[model samples]
Target: MTEEDIATASGLPVYTWRRRHGADFRARVPVINPRERLRLYDAAQATAYIKGAPIPASPADDAAHPDDLLSDKEAGVVLGIDATTVRAYATTGYLPPGTERHGRTWWTRRSITVRRDSPDQRHHSPGRQPGDLRDRAPRHRRDPRVTEVSALLLLGQVTTDEIAEHYQVGRRTAQRLLAAALTVSED
Candidate 1:
């Protein structure tokens, strides 16, 4: 088996597996060629390593509600809210910033748990009128939501198509939102 083969079996990148477990793997697989670009593994030793080694944490674990990181949907589950709301909170910076990896968003479990225990700030009186003092703020107020979302896009957490679909806006609107957000952040 090659390093790629071991990586597939271990469910980790070749570099990462090598960096963390290379010495052990090499000691076990005495026949392996260390300098080879495509490192080959001895069958028995590689199989033993693959079977005995603990699998590394994966992005997929986010959706499964792991202890360290969470996807928007997983965060929703922890908070007992809808996934869309989680996404909105994350995109608007109401929730802690999320990490972008492979075009997916992942929030810290600690952040989500903290938010779940915090008070809801969006509550309003039932009889509030359109002319209420709260509503009197200028319409042109800098909406940080778009900017935050754009930052997420720039970070590669969310895609333009996702923004358009979730916001029910056009592709152009999504692009403009990202561009505007990036411009604001740069300043």
Candidate 2:
């Protein structure tokens, strides 16, 4: 398994795991991909090791982002907060640092998820009280960006890749948004 895979299984950052138990863990497992520093561990052994490890302060809630990457909005969705809150968290170090590429902030979903699932989140959660109408209601309105992307797609003037680059979503999300918009228009 790769370092990332081990991280996913253990619910800890690879670096944190290494810092805590690197020597022992490495001695127990054989390195298969030296370039990636990946170690080979079968499923059963990996599961047992993961179960035995101490839970990190930041632990992944679920295996949500396999690629370990996400746009701010995507991270927000996973974090049960808004994009603005996500940015704030990133700025305050509540969330992991992100890279700004092409005017968009890209974060590690693993880190965001860890923060989300971590107990520390309760202290820093946004001020949304119980019985908030916005939280209870369904947001029937489509995202404006999705609508705009769909229009550009229907015009056939912009490629899907361009839409993905512009919108900071995956090609599949772009396609689905376009398809949904087209369906709505047809209706």
Candidate 3:
């Protein structure tokens, strides 16, 4: 049963079970289904834990190898990928699901190795392809008006009023274009 199940079965208030006994209960009970999000515990073991009695020792034969467990970061180091990517793969079923215990997620060594050695694990950088960068210019786009204004002002051939008349624009627009031209030319 779950924590709520154990609490309700033992006649403890929900909040009391959570705020008071939650950590203690978790510490005492080993979840039976580690691969699943919903944690499940043996009914007898849950009862034993709830009664404040010593829980029986489970079978040692069914236990995982002590050195087989690895955290996601450790798995990432093994796979040469970022920990977040490792976690993403796990969640996306590219890797085996991890077990959460004591607020840490762990994956088995075998599962990580299987993913690491898989045929499709090798990746290539998606390099430049035909028509890949048709419009990707190296520099920011500059206004043609600004360039023309800059050249005319540099040649001392036109005033802002002349620019306004030539470009058929407002006085404020001429002033702005002239200012933009000055800044662009200075740069």
lDDT of each: 0.70, 0.67, 0.78
Top candidate, metric TM-score = 1
**Candidates in descending TM-score order:** 1, 3, 2
**Pairs of colliding residues, candidate 3:** none
TM-scores of all models? 0.36, 0.31, 0.34
The 10-residue segment of model 1 with minimum total lDDT is 55-64
After superposition, the stretches of candidate 3 with alpha carbons farther than 4 Å from their true spots are 4-62, 65-113, 116-131, 138-156, 164-187
**Per-residue alpha-carbon lDDT of candidate 1 for residues 44-138, written as tens digits (9 for 90 to 100):** 56777778854333223235333455667768888998989988877666786688743567788888888788887544424577778876766
Superposed Cα deviation of residue 4, candidate 3 (Å): 4.3
Local accuracy of candidate 3 as per-residue lDDT tens digits, 1-187 = 6677887987988788888888887787787767656676777688888777889875354454544567777789889999999998877677877887546678888888777887774243244665777546788777799999988878886678988999999999999899999998798
Global fold similarity of model 3 (TM-score)? 0.34
Model 1 clash count equals 0
Runs in model 1 deviating more than 4 A are 1-67, 123-187
Model 1, TM vs. native: 0.36
Model 3 global lDDT (CA atoms, 0 to 1) = 0.78
